[model samples]
Target: MGLSDSEILMPASGADAVRAFGDGRDVTVFAGGTILMPMIAYRRYPQRARTLMLGRAGLNQISADGNVAVGAMTTLAAIAGSGVEPLAAAARDVADPEIRAQATLGGNLCAPPSRQGPRGDLQAALLAARAEVRCAVAGRERIEPIDEFLAGLDAEPRLVLGVELERPRRAAYSSQRRPHAHSYAVMAVACAELADGVRVAAAGVAKRAVRLRSVERALADGAAAEQASAGALDGLEPQDDALASSWYRREVLPVLVRRAITQLGGG
Candidate 1:
């Protein structure tokens, strides 16, 4: 189906956007259109009742005062230079400059797993940072941790407003990817030293990014980076895809985790 067949709503403000996205039923939210445009061109996108365009929704600001706040519509290009550590690095590593300029943070966070491989490269960094997601759901605004948000993504329909988080004392990111920046990573890891302790997360090991709880426990118990990273595969099953086999992802994940943790001064 073509976009011309769908009812499109372009809201000028966040409030209007929320109202237009009521319950998200049969609605496809169009952000930067980095991913959706291709689907549309190839006729792979399903026909939805409505297309809610967020380009002018007044949701593209970044705040870095006492705490950090990023609007859902902020582009990866803007975030690549935001000095947000692993997030900026991950954003810079997304696609080429043109794709990054057109991809929005909200789209990245809500990206589903693709047949080729996992696609949300920024997810690991945001997971490690322990960001909070602000979304409009069920006719109300809700704030939840990133982990919780991801866990419930398939169960509910919502409009992502933005994300908020505190600055980390130290952060590091590591990944194994094809030479082409556009290709998704085989495995990626991100770590951050927060006031409470350290958090670690990885992507490409599953359908979505996941926290390395076993590794975090080992770190809290004073295990060396190498030793702590040995637990990277606990409670997780890697999948085979075009990029690499499950075994290869399993083998390399620990290495990436160790490298990120060591880089974060946890060695």
Candidate 2:
């Protein structure tokens, strides 16, 4: 839906934007409005855009501790162009070229429907990399788990400050889409730097994006990527979409997981 109405609240910085969400007005935080504008244009939202955009400060800064700090409003183009290896590669694969140029990483993470499913691109990528989406609520607070927060999107009016993709160590994201980033049939991310060795997670196949912790453990123990059996699709419920069949998704997941892990330098 388009904005629910109100005034424009563009804070001086990202931190300032976090504070505004506390005001309790009907404020829907905006970054690039890539998702917001398109929905509105197509009449998905009934009201006009609201005031109060939480600028770069809330989720825009890239921290030096190795994690990429993206402001809630940081456009997808920014993250895609950040030159931050893993994240950059993922961005390069986002839908079509035009969408990537205008969409914000914040918008992609915050809007799940637009992202296709919980197991889609950004969520699965961050989940595997152990990323944290810093958010602000009630009384000057900060939250990290974007997954937990996203689960309850239907229930609250919370604001997304920005997502912090923690320290990167050889990582890669892969997905099954129709030749572009329009959406994903199956999306996977494999990383070797989070804890010890590599971990894999798949989105676009089920709810909450399925993490192959089991496969990760196997890899840590030195199993080759090809050794990642169908077990990699464990704990998932693939869905049928206009793009592909559920069966097709189930069949392709293991391969993608292997490719991601292997390419990231994992066995």
Candidate 3:
């Protein structure tokens, strides 16, 4: 069917949104409309006949009580403006102000990346912070760790409700750009304090965001940030894209990783 034959649904609550998404037909959940709208208008999304818009489902909330809970509909502009650690810094580097205003956390996580590479700056920071993804399907809700969620990206549930991260003692994020007018990141790194020790994560360099377990272990064993970062890339594979080559990404990974650790007080 053509776009004109589509049915746009506006759900009033989370449950209603979940129900709409599980209606047994091709349904796309629309949040922020930053990615989906363009795809539909340009005929990129052929199955746009059923779309569930959750803009008014009361999911655009961010709370910081002990742990942080950010609704999926919360805009990147709001997150960047808050000055909240790692994530805030990551959000600041996203696109322009207009794009940020229409980009939501859930949409950013689930949307496919552009040719530049993985659009997972926030995912890296969240992984280091040990965040959780809250999702709902047919009103049945569940929370999964960020690692597990990323591991199962091929089978994500119907709707993303929110994301939760524990309060960290310290956190930092860093990314490299091509110095172009509005270039996306060539590579990005994030570090955060966890109960066990410091955790590290990276994006852009890989097809998917990933945790740097070797770096984290080396740092925990008292290795210098540079040394740990170097060791972390031993068996890793980085991607090559229009903005950067695999070799360039590999060379810059340690530098960005070192910077993130340094910003977190030599972690």
lDDT of 2 at 147: 65
lDDT of 3 by residue, 236-256 (tens): 888778878899988889899
lDDT of each: 0.91, 0.64, 0.81
Candidate 3 whole-model C-alpha lDDT, 0 to 1: 0.81
Show where candidate 1 strays beyond 4 Å. none
Candidate number achieving the greatest TM-score relative to the actual structure: 1
Candidate 3 stretches with Cα past 4 Å from truth are 23-25, 46-48
For candidate 3, which ten residues in a row score worst on lDDT? 112-121
Tens-place lDDT digits, model 1, residues 1-267: 566889999999999999999999889999999889888888877579899999999899999887889999999999999998778988988879999999999999998887688988899999999999999986699999999999999899889999999988889999998998789878899998889999999999988999999999999999999999999999999999999999999889999999998998887
Please provide TM-scores, in order, for all candidate models, with all chains considered together. 0.97, 0.83, 0.93
Q: Against the correct fold, how does model 1 do in TM-score? A: 0.97
Q: List model 2 lDDT by residue over 1-267, tens digit each.
A: 434435676777655666676744466666666666776688764253455655445455555466567665665566677766566666777766677666667667766544344423566666676677666666465676766766766576566766676566677877666764465535556453664555566667765565677787777777887886446877676777666677887888887877787787766
Full candidate order by lDDT, most accurate first: 1, 3, 2
Q: What is the lDDT of candidate 2?
A: 0.64
lDDT of 1: 0.91
Clashes of 1: 0
